[model samples]
Target chain A: MLKIDNLSVKYQDGNQVLRGLSLSIENGETVGLIGANGAGKSTLLMTLVGILLPLEGTIEIDGLLQDKKNLRELRERIGVVFQNPDDQLFMSSVYDDIAFGLRNYGMSEENIKHKIDYIMKELGVEKLQNMSSHKLSGGEKRIIAIATILVMEPSVIVFDEPSSFLDPKTRRRLIHLLRNVPMTKLIATHDLDMALELCDRVIVLKDGQVYAQGNAKDILTNQKLLEEAGLELPFCLQRIEL
Target chain B: MSEIKKSINRISNLEELTYRDTVIHRLPPVIKLLMTVIFLVTVISFGSEQVSGLFPFLLYPVLLMTVAEIPMRPLLTRLLIALPFTLFAGLSNMFFSKEAAMMLGGIIITKGMLVFVSILIKTILSVMSVLILVSTTSMNDLLYAMLYLHIPTIIVLQIMMTFRYLSVLAGEISVMYHAYILRAPREKGIKLIDMGPFLGQLIIRSFDRADRIYHAMKCRGFEGGVIFSEHKKVRTTHWLGLMIVSVVLLILRFVNLSELIGQLVIG
Candidate 1:
C-alpha cells in the first residue's frame, strides 16, 4: 500500500498548499483524486514524487519510508507520470526513454532490451520504438509516456491529468489501457466520467484536505458534497438522471 | 519570430539527418570520434605554405558525403556562416607576409596569397569533418563516446540536455515574443524600460519549466551523474578502419602527395 499521513506542504512564498492531507491506496486498487483548481492536487503529486519534501508528513510505500536515504529505492516502487508527456519523455528516442530507469540501475544492455521490447509490445507501441519522442502525436506521446513508467514495473503509479490533450477516440483508448493495468493506481483528474469508469474508490479534496472519500458510486453521486468541493457530477451521471 | 521558427526547423533537420543508416553511420562512435580528432590535428599541423599538400585531405569529406548520402550544399551553406571569421583571419596574412613565393601561369603568387589560401583550406577541412561527424552520428551515441573517453558524466549529461532542449527553448522564445507583441502593439521592438521585466519573465518561465523537467527526471530514478546509454563494443572492422584512416592521414600530412602525383604525370 501507498500511504501519505497528515501531509502538509508550503510554497516558497509561504502559502500552505497541501494542508494535512492524508490518503492511502491499497495494492491492485484504482483510486480517483478529484479537486478544484487550487485544491492542491498538483502539490500532492509533487510531494509523492519527492520533488517537494513535506514540512510535516510521512510517505510510506510497501515496507519503506520516503526520506533522503530511501529516495532512490522508493522511486522504484512508486512511478509518477507528470501532467506533460513532453516532460517525462526527455530522452532522444522512445526506446532510450523506456530503458532509462533500468539503465540507471546498471542493468545489462541485453536485459534492458528484453524489458523494453516486452513493455513496448504490451503497449502496442513497438513500431514507435525508434521514433523521436518529440515527433510523436499527442496520443502516441501519451502512450510512450505510459510505457516509460510501466517499464519500471512500479508497485504503484500516479498519473496527473492523463486525458487532457487526447481526442475522444484517444481518450477512450486510454481509458481502456488504464483499465488493463493491474498495479495500484492514483489518477488525479477532472475527467469524472473516466474516474467513474476506472476508479473503484474516489477521494475528493477541498482546501487541501480530504473533503470526502468512499465508494466511487456513492461519492460521485453525492451532488451536495461535490458542490461544496467546487466540482460537479460527471456528465454521464447527469444524462442518466435526465 | 520567423528567424526563431527557422532555427527550430534547422535543429530538427540536423537531428533528422542522423537517422540515416550507412556504413560510416554504423561505425562505433568512439572510433569515429578518434578518427575525427586525428583528421583535425593533422589539418591544423599543416604549415602556411603547404597549400599543395592540403589538397589530398579534401578526399575524406568528399568520400564521407558520398557514402553517407549527406548533401554538400547545406554543409557549405553552414560554412558560409563562418566565412567572415575565417576570411578575416586569412586576409590579414596578405598584409604581413610579403615575399614572392612562385609564378603560376605567368602571374606571380606572393607568399601572403599562398598563406591566405592555406588558411582557408585548413578551415574548410576542419569544419567539414566536424559537421559530417554530427550528421552521421546520433547525439546519444556521440555522448556515449564522450563517456568512453572518460569525460565526466555530469558534463556529458549537461551537453546532452542542452542539445535536446534547444528547439524547445527556441519555441518558448517565439511564443513569448509573440505574446509580448500582441500586448504592446504600439511599441517598436521592446522599450528599454520594459526590457528588464520582459527578460525577467523569460527567466522565470525557463526556471519553472526546468524545475518540472528535473522533477520528471528524478521520478524516473535519475540520480545525478548517471549515464544511461549502453557502451557499444568495437568490432575488428571498426578498429581496422580506424588504423587505416589514421595511417593514411598521417602519410598525407608528412608526404607531398600533390608533388609526387605531378611528377608521375610529367614522367
Candidate 2:
C-alpha cells in the first residue's frame, strides 16, 4: 500500500545519501531491505515517513494519505520503530513512553490507558510499565520500543534494525512478535536469517540502488547474488533445494 | 567528563533514595507549574521594603520543597550558583540610596536591604519552585504537559527535536574528544585551542544529523507533530487538589504574620 518512486536525498552540504531509490510494499506484506552500513536504508525509510523531505521523487500510499496537508492524519497512520530504543523513548517510565504517542494524538485518557494495556499485554511486557528506560535490559528495551509504536495502531510499521543488538533467544521472540503483527512492514536489517525466515519478499540495496528483488525463496537461494550484494545466505535456506 | 558521568550516576541514585509518597507527584505538571507561578506572583506583589511580609511567604516554597522530598542541598547549591548574578545587580543599590528606614538601637538601614532581601527571597523561592518541578516531573512529562497546555506546535516540535539531536551531537563530539585524548598524551588536559576543530566539525555534522532525523520522521508519515491514538484524560480530583494547594498558598501570602514577627524581634 506504500509506493516510493525515484527518491533522492542530500545533506545541506550536498552529500548525497539516497540516489533515486525506488521501493514499494503491499498491505500486510513483510518486505526485507538488506544493505551494508551507510547504504541509505535508514534514509529511504525516513524519506517515506515524512521525517525528511526528498530532494526528488514522489511517495504515495494508496487508499491512504495522499498529501502533506493531512500530515497529522498520515503520521497517525504509520508506525516507525527507530534503531535505538534510547532515542525513540524519551519518557520517564515505560507506560509514559507508550502513552507518549497517544498523548500526541490527544487521545482520551481512558482510551490511552486501554491501548497501553492491550499492547503491553500482547508483547508480554506488562511488568515493564513502571520501569525506567535506564533499568531495562536491551531485549526489554527493544520490546518497549515496539510497544511505543504498536500502541498507536498505525496501518504501516517501519522498523530500523529491530533485532540489531538482541540476543539469539530475544531475537527469536522478537521475530515471532513481528510475525504476529498484521500491518505492512518494511524492515531494514543486515540479518539474512531474519530476512529469510520472516519476510515474504527480499530486496537487496547496494550503493543506493535496488540490485535485486524477488520472492523470498528465489532471493534466498541465490548464493552468488547474495555474496555480490555483501549478504550471506541463511544456513536453513541454503540447506533447502532451489 | 568521566567525573561528570559518575556524578550523574551518583546523583540520580541519591534522588531515587529519598522518595516521599506525597500528592504532589500525582498532580499534573501544568497545574503544578501554574501554582508555582501564582506563588511567585504573590511574593512579588507585596512591597519590597516589607521584609516581614516576605518572610512568611518563604514557607510556601520551603514547605513544598521539604515535604515534596526534594533534596534541599542540591537545590540550594544550584541557587547559590546563580546567587552572584543577583548580588551584583543588587550591589548597585549600595551606591545610590535616597531613602533610609528607621532601625533598632539607633541604627539606621537603607531601603536597599529591603529590596535586596525581596530579590534574594524571590530568587530562592523561584529556583526552589523550578527544582521541585523538575525533581517531581520528568523532562519528557514536562514536555508532554506543555503540549497539552496548548503550547505552540512548532515550539513543542523544536523542544523534542533538540532533545533528540543533543545526544547525537554529544556522541559524535565525545568520540572525537576521546580520539584526541588517546593520541595526545599529556599531564595537563587538552587546551581550549585544541578543541576548536572538533567543535567546528561537530557543528557541521550536527546540522546534517538533524536533516537525517527530519527525514526519518517524515518517512514514518510525520508531517508535523507526532500523533498517537492513546491518551488518558486527567481526572477531576487531580484538578481539585491543585486548586486547593494554590488557594491555600494565595491566602497565606497576604497575611503578613512573618513580617510582624521579624520587626518585633528586631525592635
* Top of the candidates by TM-score: 1
How far off is residue A74 in model 1, in Å?
0.8
Please, what is the whole-model Cα lDDT of each candidate in the order they appear? Answer: 0.87, 0.73
Per-residue lDDT over B30-149 for candidate 2, one digit per residue giving the tens place of the 0 to 100 score = 677677677777777777676666667667767777667676777776678778988877767655664787585787777886677777877777777777776776555566677778
lDDT of 2 at B87: 85
Candidate 1's C-alpha runs over 4 A off are A237-242, B71-77, B91-100, B184-194, B235-237
- Per-candidate iRMS values, in order, are 1.7, 5.3
User: In candidate 2, residue A219 scores what lDDT?
Assistant: 87
Residue lDDT tens for model 1, A1-242 = 99999999999899998889888888999999998999999889888878888999899999798898888898999899888898888776788888888887778889899999898888888998877777789999999889888888999999999999999999999999999998899999999999999999999999999999999989999889999999999988886743
The 10-residue segment of model 1 chain B with minimum total lDDT is B223-232
In terms of lDDT, the poorest run of 10 residues in model 2 chain A is A62-71
